[model samples]
Target: MSPSLTFRPPTTDDAALLLAWRRLPEIAAQSFSDVPDDIDRQRAWIERSNARADYVHRIIQVDGVDVGYGSITVTHAEWRIGTIGVYMGDRRGRTGIGALNFAPMLNHCFHTLGLRKLVNQIFDSNPRVLKGQALLGYRHVGVLKDHALKDGTPRDVHLFEMRAADWAAVRHRFGLFRDMDANVTG
Candidate 1:
């Protein structure tokens, strides 16, 4: 059986943890350029996000232990769309727990948050993430060539989106409800 996972709003005390994960090469490589690495900068970013109405940073816990982080950010106001980003810290990444955690997190974004669409940007070079997102029902939108510079090299990024209707159609295909109930009760 998979370890249980849960998410909660991040608190000020979590600033340090977030900073540590953000600095990890595995996590940082997948993110956009201009991501802050300094502890003070990360702390300030957390404070600012906490105060913003359109942003939420959440801590992902597995069996009561902090293992990673995820966030839902309003990306397009006119479309009522949001983007979700998640990373499984080193420990959990090796255990295949990241995908399990995303199930509930995605449901929360679509059902609880009432988001019309969820967008994810995956680096074209990161085929692992692209495959995972496809398995989760995200449709390929388009690629933004030379969209970001990571490690001082321009890289292409593929945009994927899961609309409300698409989610409703494909969610049950994974038996997500059973997993969701188990997660809630286990």
Candidate 2:
């Protein structure tokens, strides 16, 4: 059988798992946030995040094994805008499987959540993600020089945004099509 990607809400029980992924040297280097080492702190963060109405976090699994995480933080509710990011923790699952997570993520942000636009920020050091985002139809907005610090050195952050209309046009290439009645938001 072929592998499948799935997502579920993350709970405090996942603190250790998430912390381990965040602490991986490669993952830590690419992350804008500091690598968290404490389980209690991670648990607290999960708790706080789970309680927030504007934050959506998911633990990504491949055939039942947790391998990554994804999140969308609604930055401007009125404008239906949110910032999205994802990272894979399992090295075994990193062989192009991470890209599969993007479609569902985009579907959740644009289709399920009724978000009009989704913003993605990537560190200049991560060319792989930069290229993938471009190929997925995200338009480059601008670069924020010295936008973040990595290993004590300031780095640039490339901003990309995808409008619902833009995704509607290209999502089929990713095998994601629009569902006429799936986007109704109350």
Candidate 3:
């Protein structure tokens, strides 16, 4: 069966699923916060993020099933700069679906939102994320050593970026933005 992926903004209805996904041990380990077991905290977080104009939280769906989340935050400045992050729920990992979800998200950020640059920071240990980012036209900008303390140990983070011009130039190499007209019509 051919599988299709899509993304939509998160809503109150997705709070439980998001909480569940976040609760997975592997997912929590890579995230900023340990997944909260309390529903109230999850609801509060959702409410706060939903109210913020600068934050966007989206649910990624594969074959109409919610499988992951993608977020982008616009940096405050005259220039159009933003940072993006993605997390696939435990069950969705290693399935090569993350990129499918990421494609439209990138398109939306650059084309629909008019952003000039998008940045991604991946933990040095997570080569899977690094590969996914590279597949999406992000170039390795640099590495921040001992940047984050995960599980009480310092970890480095590799910074990757794709400028609007860079994306336009190398997008075809990745086949992500290739056949744009066909993707839009289908």
Candidate models: Cα lDDT each:
0.76, 0.83, 0.74
Q: Write the per-residue lDDT of candidate 2 for residues 31-141, one digit (tens) a residue.
A: 888955789999999999999999988887888788898888999999999988788899646775656677777887888888999888899989989999988889999
* Candidate 3 lDDT (Cα, 0 to 1): 0.74
Rank candidates, lDDT, best first. Answer: 2, 1, 3
Error of 1 at 158 (Å): 0.7
Q: What TM-score, over all chains together, does every model reach?
A: 0.86, 0.90, 0.85
Where does candidate 2 stray beyond 4 Å? 177-186
User: How many steric clashes between backbone atoms does each model show?
Assistant: 0, 0, 0
Q: Pick the candidate with the highest TM-score.
A: 2
- lDDT per residue as tens, model 1, 1-186: 877666777777787888888778887778785566677777778789989978766787778788888888888767879998888774964375746666776676667666789888899877878988888889999999998888889999999999878877777654454222233311
How high a TM-score does candidate 2 get? 0.90
Q: 1 or 3, which is superior by lDDT?
A: 1
lDDT: worst 10-residue window of model 2 = 177-186
Ranking by TM-score: 2, 1, 3
- Deviation from native of the Cα of residue 19 in model 2, angstroms: 0.3
